[model samples]
Target: MFVQPMWLVMLSWAVLFVGLASTAVVVVDQFVLGYRQPVKVMEMVWPVNALYLGPAAVLGYRKWGRPQSPRWLDRHGSPPRRSLNARTTIKACHCATHCTLGVLIATPVTYGFGLEMFGSTLWPEVVGDYVGAAAVGVAFRYYTEARTGGRRAWAVMRKFFMRDLLTVSVFEFALLGWLALMHFVFFHETLRPNGPVFWLIIQAGLIIGFFAAWPPTLLLTRRGVETELLSTPQ
Candidate 1:
């Protein structure tokens, strides 16, 4: 049996707790406050963000996740609404959050199966990341759109499949690029999927991925391929 260091164990538990607890808050808010109706794909996005962002995710929900209404307008005094570019950035962040959680879940499972699926040592892990991320991204879009009511079932499914493929590809591209650099250049060691260092590095990758996905998200939104959940207050 292998013994892990005390600090690493503690950090792992901490991350787990934060991930679960914060995700719960998003779920509860969605159901209790009826946020699920107005915010497209928010049911999945907020919870996924909570996994890595913890309390910051809660703050983001309050600030940007909720739909605008008269009561909200009166209280906040109608602050300048977010521009299309800003909303595009938020959507990209939401897409990246989904991918981050997916990769986190897939990494360990794929590692257990060994890395021999492809000729390259890291290819198997990369495949797992793409599969997991794409699966989650498409499923999330399906569920959210279904709940909100939409076009024909086949049409919704087809749209989401294309949307997620484009968004998740960009997200994974940036995320894996950063991880590859860290592993080959800076760390000079193989990354252990279950290790605390790997978690930290992946978190940074997710943040970078948000930026990388933004331009694509902007184009998608402008073309009406993707919908913005939060609206600018008028």
Candidate 2:
């Protein structure tokens, strides 16, 4: 009798390789193709959909879909203020500044190094792409929040579905599916395989994805402060 390799074992190994390869590609692509504007940062939408929203939806539905307050509220006795200003801004400024600086430095380093090592320049283009995407993100967030009249980010997303499972599921699925297909199918012809175009696609997808998702990230991360303002004890 012939013995077959275990599917789980093969999948685990494949996943490990994919993770490592993807990381290396990102590092190289960000500096090389991104710097060159080979692909718009909006391209990042595909990967983020595939890697983040896709998985998050599955896990969130399975784990946190029921009616329940957040753990922080449960532990800290709800929020205290609607807006965070002054001290909070000062404290956050340092971290945000550092993060921005890191991106600036990383972009150039990756671009220069990848060019020297692999004969491609991507950093500058990616920076431009991300800038555009970030602008879009900001606009989307502001418009949605303005419409909701101060609802939290998660609340806004929930409201978009009007609390209907079919609505939320369909929308999320479509968004993710569109991104995935764009990256894998529609953009396949544009990918240069071994060339710099391949690298640019990686950066673009991430940039676009992050841009589209930034509003959610901001709201989710700052929900504590917002809740505090609304729920403060009289």
lDDT of each: 0.69, 0.34
- Candidate 1: regions farther than 4 A off: 1-41, 54-56, 67-82, 117-121, 148-154, 227-234
lDDT (tens digit, per residue) of candidate 1 on 29-102? 77775555244466567787777777877777667665443345556664456778767866776687668767
Prediction 1 TM-score vs. true:
0.71
Please estimate how well model 2 matches the true structure, expressed as its whole-model Cα lDDT. Answer: 0.34
Q: Where is model 2 more than 4 Å wrong at Cα? A: 1-48, 52-57, 65-120, 148-223, 226-234
- In terms of lDDT, the best-performing candidate is 1
Quality of model 1 by C-alpha lDDT? 0.69
lDDT, candidate 2, 1-234, per-residue tens: 222236633653454445345434433443353311111221232222323223432232222211122433455553344234322322122222222233335445545455322333333333433343333333333343563385466655443333222222222233334434544466542333243333333433433433443344344335532211111123
Q: Which whole-number lDDT from 0 to 100 does residue 219 have in model 2?
A: 44
- Residue 167 lDDT in model 2? 20
